[model samples]
Target: MNEKTEELRDIFTNVTDGEETVTESQTATRGSLEKDERTIDERLENVIAQMRERYAFETTLTDEELIRVAKGFYDDVSDEDLASELEVSSEDVFDARLSLHLVESEADAPDIDLAAIRERDAADLDALADEFDASEPQIRRARRVAAAQDESRAANDRYRDEFDSILGDSELTERIASDVREDGLEDATEGMETDVSL
Candidate 1:
């Protein structure tokens, strides 16, 4: 592993106490997009617990709620829905999400002055809405997005790094490119076979 690859490999060390599987596709077929000894929810819960201890957070929500925040974020569940489900206020849900480092949705709209909106999170929402020609809810969402970006920057996104590593498989990709160039067979898919197979 080079410097960057090594840094990614150094992340969270695949559970110090976990099972290892190196099954062959021909021998055993597993169905997850990526096989893991721990399920996603289990891993999310563990990560939340670790974050709580590491950051010395004093959140009142239980372990279940923290896991929900992590899963809910990706599931596209709004803060209002999450708050309703947890029987907590939206602010409490947002705080819990940030506390778990579940923040990282950023707005990149050219029309909105996101920086100004973020800077004045506590400023009058009505004035900001008028200045930006956006609704109060829109400004509020922008503020939340800004907060998520700011908070998520504290650490590298682990799953994204994993995806990058897989997508950047130079060995396999280089071999495929070399074979294609060596064969001098342009348009490999131009007139490929489309017959039935068992």
Candidate 2:
């Protein structure tokens, strides 16, 4: 090779530290289809520990019960069902849900005004229930939902955030979506045959 070319090669080698291959580390969690890595319950237990360290507990539920609540919430289990399993009042489950930030947007009744209940969060439950023509449970639920939503608006809902962080990825998702559109959904969902082509 010419002297000029040899010098250019030397410069390139220096820049790359003489390594020809470049590799990037994959994300921490595996993709959805991977098998036998870690059970969802085990993973959730770990996440719950991390979250508890970051935030204080205000609910009456024990640490073990908190894990059950987090697991049940992720499994899409209803509060009433969790209450039955835990042998606790639905009110306790509701309180734990708020403590863990596992709240979903819901109203107590169709005509219930969340804004009105939010303003009365500290007011007497009996008076609010009477005024709204709702049960004490309904008023309690409305207050929790309203407060959680209001807080979620100002910051990310960490529990829902846990799902996306623990199970999804934005950059990889976009790239995969683009590739699927370019390749066609049928080939992706059903395996493409090599012999069949346009």
Candidate 3:
């Protein structure tokens, strides 16, 4: 319907007739179509390259956000096309889809009582997991994460208590801190030679 489309149609038509001689006009149209197609392809490639660069360095997009974007990209483009556009493997795309499902499932999961979990034996935990209709491994992972957090909190409390005890003697604390700073500075500068004559 457009000039270029008509020209392309004509080129294809001429090709189907194997015995027909290609006229100068048809030859020129064919070249023009190829050039135009190349330009369009180059533009598309440039855009995809820019998108890939931005996506790679974008720190604001969380895993969930990235998963959603990957899903959207996969839906709109073929696996090979999406992989080429994103400069990643098809396996990476599959992984993103899997991550999206995992994140969604995690979001839909019910909250567990971590304190009650800490009190429970292994058998009790398995029973609790059954009661919650969750997998034992999932419950175990949550419990492990919660226990690690509790351990971190306890370590922080101990550090705070130690610091408080140290601070109770202000003069001794200041002297000790000053000595540590001086020692650190000396060690840091030990390997470096400075020209102070100028």
Q: What lDDT score goes with residue 170 in model 2?
A: 35
Kindly indicate the candidate among 1 and 2 with the higher lDDT: 2
* Model 3 Cα lDDT, one tens digit per residue, 1-198: 999997977888788785345555544332121223333224333433443453333223334344334445424555466556666675465344332222222322247666667778867766979866778876875565455445436545342233233223334545677888899999999978787677
lDDT of 2 by residue, 1-198 (tens): 999998988888889899765578888963544243666556656766765676665677876787788767766788899999999987798777776667766522446788888777465899888888988877777876787666655556765576444444433555686876877866665865668668
Collision count of model 1: 0
Clashing pairs in 3: none
lDDT of 1 by residue, 55-172 (tens): 6553678888876765676567888998899998877777776666555445223356767877785668999889988888777767765665555555555533332333334335
Name the runs in model 2 displaced over 4 angstroms. Answer: 1-39, 62-64, 107-111, 124-131, 164-198
Q: Which residue runs of candidate 3 sit more than 4 Å off their true CA positions?
A: 1-110, 157-198
| Clash count of each predicted structure | 0, 0, 0
TM-scores of all models?
0.48, 0.52, 0.25
Rank by lDDT, highest first: 2, 1, 3
Which candidate gets the maximum TM-score versus the true structure?
Answer: 2
